[model samples]
Target: MEESNFTEKDISTVETSILSSVEASTVIIISVTWFDTRLQSIQWFGEMIMLIFITGLSIGENKVADKGKC
Candidate 1:
């Protein structure tokens, strides 16, 4: 069995990827919901939640980058 060795750079890469993916997904979701009036009632709530999550991810990514861990 081989053991996986993960470094801070690797972790930073993963976090960055996740942050980008989530940001993109949130944009797509908002755009999709924008054109569909039927889902308007829940759109704001969903987008708010996604924005909060994206914010947290951005904060974490920024901290990692600032700390020179990547």
Candidate 2:
């Protein structure tokens, strides 16, 4: 087995990027729900938006993880 060589700076950078992405996603989800509620006719649209965002987030995190392994 080989030892990993991740530095503190590298970890910090990855953490910051992840946190920022999550924070922005949360804000967008909230905004979309708020608007959907107001529209009334498109109330179900909020759920679809939430699903799309969650899927995108997962794919993005995977790519980030892959990059970190290099």
Choose the strongest candidate by TM-score. Answer: 1
Cα lDDT of model 2 overall? Answer: 0.65
Model 1 lowest lDDT segment of ten: 6-15
Which pairs clash in model 2?
none
> Tens digits of per-residue lDDT for model 2 on 1-70?
9877965554454456556666766776687677653435455466467557666766787898899999
> What is the C-alpha local distance difference test score of candidate 1?
0.69
lDDT per residue for candidate 1 within 1-70, as digits (tens), equals: 9877964544556466676767776676776788653446576677677678777777887787799965
User: Candidate 2, 31: how far from true, in Å?
Assistant: 22
How does candidate 1 fare on TM-score?
0.45
lDDT (CA) for every model shown?
A: 0.69, 0.65
Top candidate when judged by lDDT against the true structure: 1
Q: Give the Cα error of residue 44 in candidate 1, in Å.
A: 1.8
lDDT of 2 at 31: 75
State the TM-score for model 2.
0.42
